[model samples]
Target chain A: MAFPDRFDGLPAAPRCEGVYKVTGDTRGNNVAIDVLGVTKVFGAADSGFRALDKVSASIRQNEFFTLLGPSGCGKTTLLRLIAGFEFPTEGRILLDGEDIAALPPFRRPVNTVFQSYALFPHLTVAKNISFGLEMLGWPATKIASTVERMLALVKMEPMADRLTDQISGGQQQRVALARALAPNPRVLLLDEPLSALDFKLRKEMQIELKRLQGETGITFVFVTHDQEEALTMSDRIAVMSAGRILQVGSPREIYDRPTERFVADFIGETNFLEGEAKVAGDRLLEVRLDAGATVKATAPDAALHAGRTTVAVRPEHADLVPGDGPADLTGVLKNIVYFGTDTHFHMTLDNGVPFIVRQQNTPGEGSGFSIGEQVGVRLHADAAQALKD
Target chain B: MQPHEVEQAAIRRGTMRRWLLSAPALVIIFLASFGPLFVMLAFSVLEKGDYGGVKPWTFSFDGWANVFFQHDIFTGELGFADAHLSIFWRSVRLSIITTALTLVLGFPTAYFIATRPRKTREIWVFLVTIPFWTNLLIRTFAMQEVIRNEGVINTVAMRLGMISEPIQIMYTDWAVLFGMTYVYLPLMVLPLYASMEKLDFRLVEAAYDLYANRFKVLRRIILPLTKPGIIAGSILVFIPSLGAYVTPRVLGGGKNMMLGNLIGLQFGKGNNWPLGAAISITLMVVVMVALLVYVRATARAGGDDRGR
Candidate 1:
């Protein structure tokens, strides 16, 4: 399926800078969380190492912002810091303009759905859903109605009386969501909420979570290591590595126009070609690859210097045709993998530079490219992105 | 080929291996433990000779009759009535006191130790269990020295002029309770620690998140979760305290003799094996009945909590 029309105006070719800010309709003027220069260290003073180093990001109210990174990238730690489970060794966190640095987890105006789903095993689904409401000292009548509403919202009303262990994992996840949402906190933090579910269930919950976010209008700060999940669910993703954010933008911007080599490799599969750049025109540039070949690409920013650099070209951008054409590289097909909807051909260039080309699986007989067959890998030079050294 | 045949073969193999491995220890346990109990039962019902040894196979209730009906020859104290009523009640009272004290003190200490960080918790648990490694008699003697006149406490009190005479702190009921609690404190703490360590702190956190204060958390979440440990610790402390002879014998002087001492007297110096056996049998029956009742009550309570 194609992307929704709402995302059509998004830059088709990755733009380098000035991505749109995500401010949900419900929270026009509110800044839900303003985390500044947050740093966290683990272990004791003599041996402790930094886990988050001067990390800073602002999540708008009612926006579903995701902290995306690979494992050990401090994304979860940053989320935990925002949730008040861990205090930052340095820096400040402001919720609605109040410093919540010294606040305990229970006192913070946020609730977390832990990655483990940490439901009280002894409590029933109804009791689990109503826990936060009871904590807020709501009347029994109000709590009952609220729990019933949340149960319906998460489509778990039928299993309300079942023990957490009695229900399926998906049902328990909904109960956890209900429990966290029942408090009606200003921000709801999820730590890899869907990582525990099967692929289909994860996809189903992704839609449910997005719909719930729209309905409730509560700001959500989701942490995930899955790049696809981050792309699918986040309004804006903060791509992080080695305790620092490399780039923060909408999913399209992060994917299409990554700011660094780490962001490019971390977000999706890309073929890196080391080259030198020279600005050719207002929006065009010439890159000389290390293999003594020159190619044309879009110059996204002035940071593209006239020195050795790397060019990141996504696999889908490279087209495999019948013969050599403009801005083309000749190669032999080493491997072809048919993945039901698309075919990927691993091609090695004449200079021994390896690259992949992916073609959509259309109806009728598609291109029958065989292994060890000679082919020309064509590239739309405009689709290639020039990166800073 | 058939399911029943396969099942039978597996069962036969399992039984053969189990018997081969356990036969020696099982025989030794039966001979060493149950043999004496059977002999005691038989001797309790047999007739006593004029010289006071058991008359083999001459079964009679004369020994039991003498125990229940006969008065003391020396002090005219009713042998059965006074010993059974006073000594039994004294032992029960002392055991109840020790068990309650152990529960009160051990619960907090166990909770603290269970909640410590991993490395520090290991050290604390080790310290709590260290006292149990010492000899029980040696521990009792150490307590004796601490509470005795001219011992460390009295020496200090005398030197400070807190009292003109060395306080009569030793050989009292308080001293007996103190010694019992000291010796059995580790037993109570260890079991309670085991249960409390398994307690998910998240439950307590959940309670607090549900607006439960610290005291409410203790009463509702902690107390109910650690009930098994409390029950087990109480039984451990109470059963041992009821049958304790040495601690009271040394610390209670001669004034506060418990049932164990009386049972010992009847069998040893008193030369009445049937009465001693009957008393011992009665004490065992009472303890067993108490244990059964406690277990039944706790099981019912646990069921009710789950129902809620």
Candidate 2:
């Protein structure tokens, strides 16, 4: 696990046996959490639910790391393991290079902002914020000052005397965050903390969370099903599916070049076209579609190229052309959808497959095509990505 | 004919229908409660008969006066009624001890039943209530057999060579306490289990996550949250133990008489029906006062009860 010095501070690249490869710097590395082949199974051994199947991940210090997936995808299970709520069934979790697997949740220097906020109903907001500090046996003066500081940090100074159940959902969310941060844990785990808020409030809290992370500089491992929230907040994202980590990369890397099938379909809207691919050049792929069109696509991993595979393309990667010249595929325009900032032109190809082309709206200019009209979509040179499925 | 008048007439008809539907229950409650209360009050102010019954239409204050003081046979002076006072004191003291003991024993039992898996919880609660299927007198006599001389405990101890003589436990206050606590235990556990069942266990996990150990979680979270159940169970056990006649009479063996047995003594052999009725009224007053103080302290402990 030699982390290269160049990638040390910027991205904190994860280097594992099957995930990444790095060189040069081997010492003086700061790894906040290294989950080594963690497996979690609920109930009996013979007949049990395998929530996580030997999932491995490396979260670095002060990184805004996200585990993004749909529901029941082991993201929350992984977060709970890190927060010491659930112990690994067969592996070790190293926090700051120390094995914290044997420590209970109270002994571990970690805190969680649960999705339900789980605040003490009998205590006021200030007492709730200072609960962790009180449990740690800090002096009354120190606890009082810290409670005041947390109240001001969450912008809930006036709500100090109000009970937790008496506050609004958004206010309770702020108090939960402040309470978890009061203890100043080495790592903070958040399990879908923003999923309960409305769209507008969720957006505001997303930015607020990023700001807080930047200010505190604690390693934050956030779990969410919302891909847009993950992309908007994370420094690096790990896309998971079905008790395993599907892919781990930057959001742009995950979106533009998903290495696997489920990752391609899960991250965002992807168009899949079956084709026979051949190695064109160095890191270049020549894919011949089933519809008699030969297009040059970029290989995500050149070493893993195969002959018969599917090429995934995003809707925004292609533009609709009137004639067939300089077009990758020609089809009939089936439908047109207009959004506020973009429009989607639904085209049925000559092979009878549904293909969508998205184009930005330039103020009063339409897509310049009507329904049932013949159209062709031209792909950018880097749009089509070769999947190794 | 008008819409407003028709609507008002319909509203009036609905109110009449509601009252009609509840009339039977209200009438039964009044007849069952106030009817006996009036008879008891009337008998308490009447003159005592020669044998057992009270004389009609002849009012006397001797029954009420005898409650606190007794006239001396030689000096014609009123003195403190030490016998009646001691009996009342013993009843109150035993009831409080019984309530405290049941709470200490029943809390852990209720918590255990509440924390069991949902399917098994019903079985545990059903077991707790199984004692109610039999008669209270039978249960008290069964308990007497366990604590009496030459009974189960003494016989087992002697057989095991652990004692040379039988322990004199049956005709003591300990016997009465044990019997009352045994009979009234289910009353405490049931309400406590009901409250513990509704507890949000995530809060307990949250406390543990925040560095609070097991004792702190019980004291700060579980105890306060289930105060309503604790108060309800205490009152349930305390009221019954206060007026409990069968257990104390069967186990106390006429020497350790409680308020219930003392009041019964007036009616059965004392030949003073007025004094018995007066003592019965006094016992009811003590129960009411105990309930008031318990409720007031519990209400203060839980401000406004909205959280529960």
Task: List pairs with backbone clashes in candidate 1.
Answer: none
lDDT (tens digit, per residue) of candidate 1 on A1-389: 11111112333222112222454442334567888899899987447878899998888766789999989999988988887768999999988777998887767758888787877765678878877666666778878888888898999988887878899988888888888887676788998999999999999999999988877777889999999999998888999999999888889888877768888898888988877788877756788876556788665574455777788889998789764454367778899888998998898877889989889899898677778888887776565777654
Model 2, stretches more than 4 Å misplaced?
A1-28, A280-284, A295-303, B1-23, B72-76, B303-308
lDDT of 2 by residue, A1-389 (tens): 22112111334333323222222322236567898899999987658899999998888777778999999999999988887788888898988788998788888778899899999888889888888887888778878887888788789999998898889999999999999888777778898999899999999899889877766667789999998998888878899998999888778888898887788888778888888888888767888998667777777673247589788889999889996466788889999998989888888989988898988999776767899998888888788888867
lDDT (Cα, tens digit) per residue for candidate 1, span B1-308: 79999999999999999999999999999999899888777777887665556778788875566544667789877556654677788899999999999999999999999999978999998999898788888888888999999788989998999988998878888999998999889889989999999998866655554445677668767898788899989998999899998889888888888878877887787777777777777788879998999899988886654434
Assess every candidate by TM-score: 0.83, 0.91
* CAPRI class assigned to model 2: acceptable
> Chain A TM-score for each candidate, in the given order?
0.89, 0.91
lDDT of 2 by residue, B1-308 (tens): 89999999999999999999999999999999999989998999999998889989999979988988898889988999888999999999999999999999999999999999999999999999999999989988899889989799999999999999999999899999999989999999999999999999988888888888889889878998888899999999998888889999999988999988988888999988889889999989999998998888877766642222
